[model samples]
Target chain A: MGEVIVITSGKGGVGKTTSTANIGTGMAMMGKKVALIDTDIGLRNLDVVMGLENRIVYNLVDVVENNCRIKQALIKDKRYPNLYLLPSAQTKDKTAVTPEQMKKLTSELRNEFDYILLDCPAGIEQGFKNAIAGADRALVVTTPEVSAVRDADRIIGLLEANDINKTHLIVNRLRADMVKEGNMMSSDDVVEILAIDLIGIVPDDEHIVISANNGEPLAGSDCQAGQAYMNISKRILGENVPYLDLEVTKTFFQRFASIFKR
Target chain B: MGFLSNWFKSSESSSDIAKSRLKLAITSDRAVCSPELMEQMKNDIIKVISKYVDIDTKGLDIKVTRTELDDESGTVNAVLASIPIKDKRPFRG
Candidate 1:
């Protein structure tokens, strides 16, 4: 009985795909059989993020439409042998997949993989419903901005209404300097407003963009965002890992000194 | 003198303002009522009460908020309306 977690945010461009790619890769690096599903359908990008777009011969629509076997549609990651991506169909719309089909797909995947992560599209529409239909838990991603937090709150309410009660928050793209200057909401502030358990916070790092451009997830790397993703993965595996200390990025000496403490 | 004055100024941070605004917006959102709807409801209540007694519309305040339950089980969406009564209307009958 594997766990199926949905990565969702009601607003676009909040790093849902990036989190899904990194966390799935992070879990695979830890020796778990993980499958990442891009439920975005027409706006598919998870394959590109995972750098497996060139290897995709079949997609989610093909699998659901009985055009190919599930094994044929699964793409092996370039770096991790255990991580696989089920790419979405770029030509098909969100209406192509129903919640029942998603539930059945996840149930079948659950028998083989340790974790199945669904990268949901941005909205409270049919795609969101389909992604969460088979999920056992949810990780709501949001930035520290007002609009992102507002949409996060909306997503939380919808998740609860659908009875997916095991939900956690990941506040991404936090600027430590802005937070220190009282110009942006801290993670604590975000958690207080959303009234949910926080899983992790990824600092705003340029390395994240670089890794995304290269189609390589930063989870196993030594960058701050990479470390953050790795920590989030450990937490997902039921480890009692502490949150990443954002202030560690302030000084070179401190970053070097803290490595010894680890 | 500059530091002292700065300390006494008591200006709110931008994040603080954002927090308060989000709180207010979410409270109304969970209540399933927009700001316009809340205003309309307030006016209707004022009109109905005004026929029976003189009410101070200027002093009226209505807010949508969350209230903690008595048993501490969880909080619930609540509407808190404060209507000031000025005087009773004379009976025509």
Candidate 2:
């Protein structure tokens, strides 16, 4: 059976949708059948982020509403044969789908795909509850900013309260240079504060924005952020991939440590 | 003047400040009582304790913080009560 994982953040614009797309694509490339579900309903942007917006003839609401089959609502990604997207309806609000329906839907999906990733909406509302209702694991995405980290902490508390015992963290859009200068928080800082297992740390890359705008996920590529997502996918697949050297711009400890290894 | 001002300024960067602040915030969130509630409890404890003994109110520190009681529920907030005495009383062993 496929594991159901939800990507969430307490605050908006922390790259939950982007991380969902890239991780889904990376897993598919690794020969795992993956389905990306956009659960944001009214503010659906996962389709746009995945560059599958133009092909959405049906959406999540259609599947839940029984207007269309789940297979029909799923949009296959051209880049990766195993990767598919279940887009959310633009016209319907979050109330269009209920937590019970989501639970049932994900259970059905668990039988078909190796990974069922839910792109959760920001904030701890009905949308968040529905997204996590059927999830066995959670990945809380956050930036290096105080607000993002604070929201991530809040989400971790909520996830623990809900009995989602398996929770990991993804720190995205990390600028190494700023971290070195002490202008921004480091991955260590975030992980230390959140006290959750660190799944991946993605660097700040211009290609991420470019790929999002162009409807392409940069996974399985040389893009730093994309490579980070790929590494996270491998880790999720039970691979012991060592973390990337994304300790912000400062390599003081790393450099100091490497000197001894050499 | 420059040396004194530099000495007064802490070496903690903004990121350090953020980590410390977030740690405090999350601890409070997990705590059962709010800041005001903790404050009231502290005052009440002080009032009751001062009925028999002279204590240093300014030096006294009490907070509703985490306690290492149960390993599993270590995050559960608990009260830390400490009161300093102003004078010592003679005792016979």
Candidate 3:
């Protein structure tokens, strides 16, 4: 059976869609049958982020509304095998789907896939609720900003309230320079505040924007952010992978001295 | 010398301020109890404990936190009260 994991952040533009795309693609590369479902309803973007928008004929609403079979609604990825995407209905709003309907669809999906990642919409509204309804676990993504961390804390509380106790934290877009200057929070700081298991920390990289616009997530790429996402996927697969040294971009002397200190 | 000073300043990062503020905020947010309620409870605790010995109420810190239960089933919301002392002697009866 598969586990349905919801990627949510109460604040918008916190990289929930990007994380969903990259992590799902990484998991599929490990030979695990993975599926990414965009539950953002009218504000669908995961299909485009994964560069599969042109192929989406039927969407989540079609599957739940009986317009098509679940298999018919699934769009196979062109790049990665054992990976699929279930696009959201761009015409209808979040109210078009309910938590109960999501539960039904994911329950059916569990039998076929190893991991089903739900790309949740922002806020604590109906869209967020519907995305998490079928989820057994949650990955709360947040940037190091105070506002994003505050909202992520609230989302974690809400997930636990709904009996989804197995929640993890993904601190996204961390800038080492800002953190060194005391202008940004470190990943350790976020973990201490949110009090959840640390799953991954994706650095703030320009490649993310470039890849997203080109309809590709940073999966399997050799960039720093791509490597982090790959590490997170391995952790999800029960492999205890240590985090990469994000502070590796230091001056040559600093990097050399650190080896002796350790 | 200016560059060296800048590097030292980063060690005392403003993250300390954020950590303290967030800790207080999340304690209130847990809804185990409100901040006002926790203040009242802390006062009452000091009053009760003070009958036995002198306490430094100003230094007392009481907050609601989550603690894992021994049974490993789930967590339980708990109140942690740390009261500093001013003197060791008991109050006169």
Model 2 per-residue lDDT tens digits across residues B25-81: 776666667778878888889889887787899999777654445666435456776
lDDT of 1 at A140: 100
Residue range A203-232, candidate 1, lDDT tens digits:
999998998899999897998899999999
| lDDT string, candidate 2, A1-262, tens digits | 9999999999999999999999999899999999999999888899988888889899999999999999999999978888899999999888899999999999999999999999999999999999999999999999988889988988987887788979999999988867875678999999988878899999989999999989889897886888899999999999999877765443789767644543
Q: What DockQ does model 2 achieve?
A: 0.34
The local distance difference test score of each candidate is 0.90, 0.88, 0.89
Docking class of 2: acceptable
What TM value does chain A in model 3 reach?
0.94
What DockQ does each listed candidate score? 0.32, 0.34, 0.34
Ranking by lDDT: 1, 3, 2
* Candidate with more favorable, higher lDDT: 2 or 3: 3
The sequence of per-residue lDDT tens digits that candidate 3 reaches over residues A62-122 is: 9999999999999999888799999999999779999999999999999999999999999
What are the runs in model 2 whose C-alpha is more than 4 Å off? Answer: A247-262, B1-10, B44-77, B80-93
TM-score of chain B, candidate 3?
0.65
